[model samples]
Target: MNQIDFITEIQKHEPKMFGLAISILKNRDLAKDGLQESAIKLWNQRDYFQKVKNKQAYCMQIIKNWCYDELKRKVNNHLRLQDDEEVEEGIGNEKDHVNDTYRRIKSLIEKLPSKQRLIIQLKDFEGLDFEEISNALKMEQGSVRVNLSRARKRLKEMYLEQENKIKMIQNEE
Candidate 1:
């Protein structure tokens, strides 16, 4: 796309892109860096990007790929990030319950198979429709729906399992 079109497209999806980065990286700083790097990468590939039919989906894909790459690099290098702490510590306050629920859901999401987790993030968190998610992930729309359904079911099962364990512990105590 041309400069104006590219900039417009990126800006339109910037928030969602950043959200995707945050979901994958789980760190604001790394998300920001990933976003910037993705932008640079997109800019470098502008010529090829010009022929892309779904610019937003393409952009999202780039962000997702970069985040995964960064994660793999960290793991390969045995790099420890400060933000990799467990979320079990109660943030203890008025919002503790809400925070805890959010953390628990996020933790469960991370447990999902990578493709299913990514599909969930794209559809639920990024507010992308099945077709959009399909384009972003290069999967068929039917496949996208199937993956989302499976991810939701898995999340619900996991949440209930965790709740049951917590309840049993409380009862024992």
Candidate 2:
């Protein structure tokens, strides 16, 4: 791809890629840095872009790989820390139930196994089809679908269990 086309393509998936980075890194600043790094890497490999079938999947895979590498480096350096405040901004002093629900679901997702969590994020958040997810995750399409199904089922079960616990607490109160 040419310069303009390559840039346009990257911009098209920028938001989803950023979201993936943030989800993995859990910090806005680091996510931004990851995106910049991924962009530079993509630019360097632009010549080979012509051979890529699903550029979106390829972009996501790159971001995922880079984020994992960053996480490993941080772990090795003993610098792994939570960026709770920067994770999801504007949650302070708000009476928004939707935001609460979002947080709860996000936490539930975080509790999922690595493959299922990644598949759920890729399919639901990034809006990638099974084939794209399979390509990005390097899994079979059937495996991707099965993992997504299991993830959704597990999330629903967890949500219901939480609700039940809330109800029990209310009853005790």
Candidate 3:
């Protein structure tokens, strides 16, 4: 692909790439950095774009790899430190139940295993099909479907469990 075409294609899929990064990194600032790095890397390797059969998948893979590397680096730097205290402090006023529920759901999703989370994010959030997700993650299409299903099922169970807990607490009141 030429310079213009490469830029245009990256722009077209930038949102999806950002979403993938955020899903993996679980931080907007870091996701932006990952996306920027991925874009630069992709631009530098523009010569190989012509040989790529699936540009979107290739771009997603680049973003995913960048995020994974960032996560690993973070783990190495803060092996004993935990960020949960900071995250809890950032929780807004209790009056906003909607925001609380949203945060809870997001947190639950983040707790899922890496592969399941990636499959869920790519397939459901980014609207990528099984084949696309498989290509991006380098897994079989069947494995992608299975992982997505398992992720969704696990999220549903978590939601229901939380709902029951809330009901039990309200009952005591």
Q: Give per-candidate clash totals.
A: 1, 0, 0
Model 1 error, position 138 (Å): 1.4
Error of 1 at 64 (Å): 2.8
TM-score computed on alpha carbons, candidate 3: 0.82
Better of 1 and 3 by TM-score: 3
Stretches off by above 4 angstroms in model 2 are 81-83, 86-95
Please identify which of the two predictions, 2 or 3, would achieve the higher lDDT against the true structure: 2
| CA error at residue 14 for candidate 2, angstroms | 1.3
Weakest lDDT window of 10 consecutive positions for candidate 2: 80-89
Q: Which ten residues in a row have the lowest lDDT in candidate 1?
A: 81-90
Give the TM-scores of the predictions, in the order they appear.
0.77, 0.86, 0.82
Candidate 2 to truth, TM: 0.86
Shift of residue 95 alpha carbon in model 3, Å: 13
Q: Which regions of candidate 3 fall more than 4 Å away from where they truly are?
A: 79-100
Predicted candidate 3 versus true structure: per-residue lDDT over 75-105, tens digit per residue = 8888532323223344557646766666687
Inter-residue clash pairs, candidate 2: none
Native-vs-model 2 lDDT? 0.84
